[model samples]
Target: MPGVTDNRKSVLITGCSPGGIGNSLAREFHQSNLRVLATARDAANIADLAELGIETLSLVVDDLESVKACFADVETRLGDKGLDYLWPKYVNNVEDTKYYTVPAMEVEISEVRKTFETNLFAVITMCQTFLPLLIKAKGTIVQVGSVAGIIPYVFGSVYNASKAALHSFSDTLRVELAPFGVHVTTIVTGGVQSRIARTQRTLLPNSMYTPIESEYSRRVTHSQHNAMPHDAYARSVVAQVLYGPAPWRWLWPWAKGRKAWIWEGHRSWLIWFLLARGRPIAAAFKAATGPSVQSRLAMQQKRNLSIHEYLSARLLKTYGIGVPNGEVARSGEEAEAVAKSIGNDDMVIKAQVLAGGRGKGHFDNGLKGGVRVIYSPTEAKMFANQMIGHKLITKQTGAAGRDCNSVLICERKFARREFYLAILMDRALQTPIIVSSSQGGMDIEAVAKENPEAITTTPIDINTGVTDEIARTIAIDLGFSEQCIEEAKTTIQNLYKVFMERDATQIEINPLSETSDHQVLAMDAKLGFDENAEFRQKEVFSWRDHSQEDADELDGDIGCLVNGAGLAMATMDIIKLNGGSPANFLDVGGGATPAAIKSAFELITSDPKVSAIFVNIFGGIVRCDAIAQGLINVVQEMGLRTPIVARLQGTNMEQAHKLINESGLKIFSMEDLQNAAEKSVQFSKVVKMAREIDVGVEFTLDI
Candidate 1:
């Protein structure tokens, strides 16, 4: 009312709450000597602006009557000279509509409609209502947009869609309004520090994204810390809006050099560059929302079940494959008795440890070798005494070697010719394949790398299996003697039977040998079974020595509990990638029952170095809700102090989220693999730091 008689440019701005972009814009425009009208839902919110000689109004942008009343008031104040600028700053209550940080599936349809009403439709109504005044003065319309419209960030589906629609509308409006002498400028904003960013948003109670609630919170206030100040943003925007361009100039059309789309705020340059180059931002989006390849590989690795050499030999014997007579011994007297029972002058004693390079390994009890050849029972006894209770360190075993709980004493056989043969599943072909090489009794991996040409692979049909013709051809190719060819063929067929019948993933015979007596024998064997087949292969699984495996369980900081081997391996790889050491890799199996989950937690927490536990489960065979209940039960029962990060996906995940949230425990549920891994690593570091401080304080007090 005071500036109604004066000849000054007037600008009306919406959503001018304190500490907001609209409020700062109002102040900036007022400083530039313009008659600024700052409006909010409540006029009292912008009283500070009114105190600074800026006109304040209460205008609900969404209400048509409110828009009409505000427009009529402005029309009376301006009289002949119309409004110069209209800034419609779209701002919604974050608490009511968390569509900005919620997944598309989890966002309510009603909230989506409300977002469009406020962000797009209401703004359009404002422009339509004020177009007459804007045309009278040849003024500009500034539509506040965001980079999220063009670049797809995580968990911003509805909000991004609304902004994108607004941008398109502005682009068309800019061209259509050119002839009317009313310019429309869409401000493509990046991160700007404002009150809206400070407002915390939460996911819906039944949200599928409940696991990633922390990520949503992080993204909601992401711009709060490192964003450009609202005042700074306001200064730049006002400067460009006021004197940047002429709305109507028929004499000089080229003089209209104002940007139709103005990019401002922090990271605006990066957004512009990305847009210009047409690069896909989906990868960046996926990195924050989806599971990684490393996690999948880790899960696959967990399903493999490897057995000891003696067990493998026993399996080979069961299949009627030729092997040297051998017996397991736990003590020196037992080894001597086994040697005598064999009734052979020459015998070999091998430490029963689950690792490669046993021949080249040394015992921790000052024994020179794990595998030794003896001519008599007395010599066998002496070597067995040294190896039975000692840890055998090999290339495969690190400094902390595997204990030799028993030894295998077998009658020695001289090999006339040695060859390598193996039956394994070919993942790509989805069938079994036989791999063979003339080179044997050495490192198979090195041989494959150095002399790849020497190796031969033959895919086996699942229906027909290994035919006599296939086995004979393989025997001849391996250079078996004419006398041993039939025996070799039989052995090959039997090995295939063992592979199929036992659900074996891999059966590797390092030396399928032709003995001095022209006997074809499997001299040394290693078998790996599919862990998923544990129900059927109970006997094979029974031979599993848990003590000899998962050596890192004692030393690592983060304990991993994953359902599948591939996922488990990926979890571990991601943990290491994020600078956290995995203390143990435990697959609770596909069942994921309460007992299994409880056992897994107990095992993981047993290691004092495990500061945090990461449970990454994909519930395909098992329900995620079941696993979640089990996890809650374990934590409450055990009273676990170590922090747990559980990422459950697949079957009944929504129910799982509900169970976890209602559990009232300190466990963190995460949806993104990368975020979960990073959180686990962070928790581990915090725990370690706390422990170190406690130790330091205790040491000082002791002194």
Candidate 2:
């Protein structure tokens, strides 16, 4: 009799915007004769929600104060019987009720903190707070999720992150609530037509673009806009919430739209044609996967954190640090004026585009243009006006216009301090640690020479906050007074907090200046944050100086793409390794296709160094038989003798082996990386032997 009153099905709805799931669910639940307690950040955001004659309340997930108040209001409204969502945890759910969030992409440190409070902690809080009510009700708990919870896409990172976290949370809830008669079900939808679709960045800004520009921007853009309507998505959400067949996940479209069904119907046809032929598709797979592996490995090898001087200049200016004073002169007059202000006849007026290259100036004597070491103020001023808003051509940017906006307007500070104090993450310490020295400026290595003992490393924990103990250790080394040491500790602590909370990868500060007046300034700063952590950090993304960042060859392109960072980098390196520089890096990931392979091949061969090509593919989920057919097609379309070497392993290898071995040219069967590497490297040897033996050689790879 006690449980009968609370036998109605219920859900913890999230994201109760005007046109959102929560509101829609509220209306649906009420219409279906189930209980509805609608909620939103602002009561007015859901005033119309009130018009629906259901529960509406203000619940700000981040602020504990707001959370406590919202629950109290809920209890007051219902009296004796009310309440399921007390929200003890600060996190709010973004799927049905909250926004999507990922740890790496969510970067506004505070926003990330807030998002977690809403999406994650709030779930815990609400569960604990409503434990008594939920137990009494004996109802099923429904959590809304999105496709992003599984797939990795660009942008929507934070939203996806939150949903994924919720998915995990729901799983835990299901296990824990099993004995208490509480059932948990998750809804994972794809292409839901919602306000999110309308508001989503259809054509993201250049900032969102990976280093490479997309060739299929139109196709990609169109696909993005073609998502399913919100109502259809809502219906499924309601069904899952009201029903209780929860095993792991419930994909909508029932038997009709299950991905495996669609994949078989669609891709199977293409696969069958290849399987029937047993010739073309097998060839192409071998061909495409060949270069992809090498490209991935090359990418990994070159990824480094070495600081460029251009970035070093600005970072040194922050933290009260100082670098050599420089002038932002465009024309000769401005250069002269800047020189006059300095009152020094000798001046170094360098090209201000965020690039490297000045010593290799256009003309000798360092005077014609670009960057010149002028002896007089008039000469400096003359160079300034000429460069203002004008393209500064260098070997790197070529003749095209550069994105140069500001010039460093500074007075020269000649070599007074030259010590390098870099606060680096010594993986050994596995934390943000400090590195300092007495010397400042110029050659950091030279300073390391004069006195290596001058440098000191200090580790700190930001949670306990800055303490007096660490302050004393640093003070003793830097020779600071107790007060100054305490101040220094506070600064260090703040900086460390910035590093961890913000998801920064590295914050390199070189030459922490101990000015002549005993004042400390950061002479230069070189900061790099995990790009994936951008969602949580607004400032980190804003500070991106593409001026110093090189474009990734495989970033955004149409190519015979394969996935795996290590493999992609290696493929690129191999091409270069074999004296054939890859045109670009393109990986197909889980969606590797012959067409994609063609695109990758085109992009890779775009470089003249790619005389011919060698492709090595390790098909794990992708069957080697499919890869072989792809290669066979490639050779038939593009013609064999395009100078290709392929080594394929994993499932269907036998079938693939049969296809390649039977193809006109002998598909070299080499075991292990040693022979495979040597085969590609010794393409000349292969080519010469085949030629000497009077075999047909396609193209001459001049390696």
Candidate 3:
């Protein structure tokens, strides 16, 4: 009112509470010598601005009568001078209700209405009520918008929709107000530090997102960290409004200009570029919610459980199936004693490693072969000494060979005919099937690939099992000798019994031999049992050789801990796509607890080649916050030096992120898959470079 008759300009700013963009903007405008009218729902909220000599008014933007009264008051104070600038900046208050972050289906309809009314309807009403005064002064209308309107972030659907509608409204208003000599500017704000998210937030009691409820508070305050300061944002916005390009230039007959859509705050430019280029934001979203790698690994583990040759032979003997007289020995002296007890002139000593191609494989202890024929007990001891307590590297073993803790000594049997016989689960038919082949003592996979017709398959009904007729048919098809036909048929029936009783997924006897003595024997056996049946098959499960299992170390630079097989593959694929090498694929499983998380970290860190670790988990059956806390504990307990990039989604993901951030560890929490992958690769390279430099220094010192 005091500056009404003066030459100074005037601005009416709403939602100008302390520590907000509007409050800072009001002060900035006043510092520039303009008459400022800062308004809040409660005048006491803007008392700090009032103390700075700025006029404060109590106005509720959503209340129609309050908007009209405020307009009348401004009209009376300004008289013919009118208002030079109209700024409406208001958002739905989360403190008003606890169900603000609940899923769309669970949130109350009234809360949705309130949000729309506050963010969209209120601004439109404010603009309509003050348009006359604004037009009279040819002032600018600054509509505060947000990146949330453009980006589809989780847990703020209502707020995002309200802001999106406001954005659309501002675009239409800009075109409509061009001829009126009034300007409409939309501020597409990114992450700016503000009081909007200061209050604590919660989801509904029966929310479907309850598993991720810890994420709600984190999402509410997501912009508070590393966000542009409110004052800095205000300075940039005011500078753009007062000195940037004119909004109506595009509407003129000769000039070509567009409406002002200022993108300010952190990551604004990157988001704009991504949106403009039509990048797949949804892919990033999928990376968070995809099946966990741990779940897939659990499935893989359950489906794959095979025993060693010696154990398979022992099981065969129990079922009345003929096998070579053999004994497993952990030491060379024991192997000699077993060979001597058998009293055979010819014997075969084989390294008891899990991998195939054992006969052709070389041992780490300078043994030329894993399997060897011996003529005496002394020869058996010599070969056993070379085979035991050494690593056997085969085609299947890769460079990291399997450890051999024992050797099998058996009397060599001369076979008149060698044939392959196997009992396998036919998943498609949901039954057991017996496969027989005339070709044996060679790779079954190779035989199948090279000559599929050489194999004969016979399905067995679970109720009837392997009858005498079926066993005889398989023996005849396998080309068993006439004298050994009855023996072969009995062996086949006994093998089937072993398969069913042991819950065997597969039982293969490569070279089910017909000896010169007219005896049918399972010369070599391989058996795989169902891990799900471990409770009942306790003895079989106990025979599981952990040293035979695949190692966690992959000889790469980036260690990965993911939850699902598909997701783990995708995580690795994306890492490779981004020019980074993954060290290993370790799935912690769907029901991962803190203990499992610690174990996973320990396994990943066990690889000295790993310079960085990437943890990508989608918390479908697991709480992400629990996983996060576990990771924090592991890092602190182990004092891990490797950099970690963690991207957690679903249940309690936000809370997980909060814990990791507050833990002050080397773990980097990222929401976007691409960003997380790139950061991991970047950190890995830095660590590698540092290692190389250290190595160089060490070499120089030694010289």
Candidate 1 vs candidate 3: the TM-score winner is: 3
* Candidate 1 local lDDT, 225-281, one digit each (tens): 334577866765564455331111111233222232122222222222221112111
List, residue by residue over 1-703, the lDDT tens digit for candidate 3: 4755867788899978776677889988887788889898888888898888988888989899999999998888887887888987764453553433445766678888888888889999999999999889867788654545422335667767777788778767765664465667664433466444454566657767677766555655434433457776676566445533221121121321122222222222222222211211111111111111111111233335778899999989998999999899899899999999989889999899987788888988778788889999899888888888889998767787899999999999999899988777643233576777898888665565457578766667788888899888888888887888788889998999999999887788889999899889899988888778998999999999987876543457999998865457557756765778788767787767778888998888878788889998877567889888888888899998788899987667879988988887778899887788888898888888888887421110000
Q: How many backbone clashes does candidate 3 have?
A: 11
The CA root-mean-square deviation of candidate 1, after full C-alpha superposition on the true structure, stands at 23.0
Report model 1's TM-score to 2 decimal places: 0.50
Tens digit of per-residue lDDT, candidate 2, span 415-507: 333444445443222345555555545444334334545555555443454466765566456654444555555555555555566565555
> What C-alpha lDDT, on a 0 to 100 scale, does residue 312 get in candidate 3?
92
TM-scores for all candidates: the values are 0.50, 0.44, 0.51
For candidate 1, which ten residues in a row score worst on lDDT?
A: 287-296
RMSD of 2: 22.5
Query: In TM-score terms, which candidate is top?
Result: 3
* Full-model lDDT for every candidate: 0.73, 0.48, 0.72
What's the best-to-worst order under TM-score? 3, 1, 2
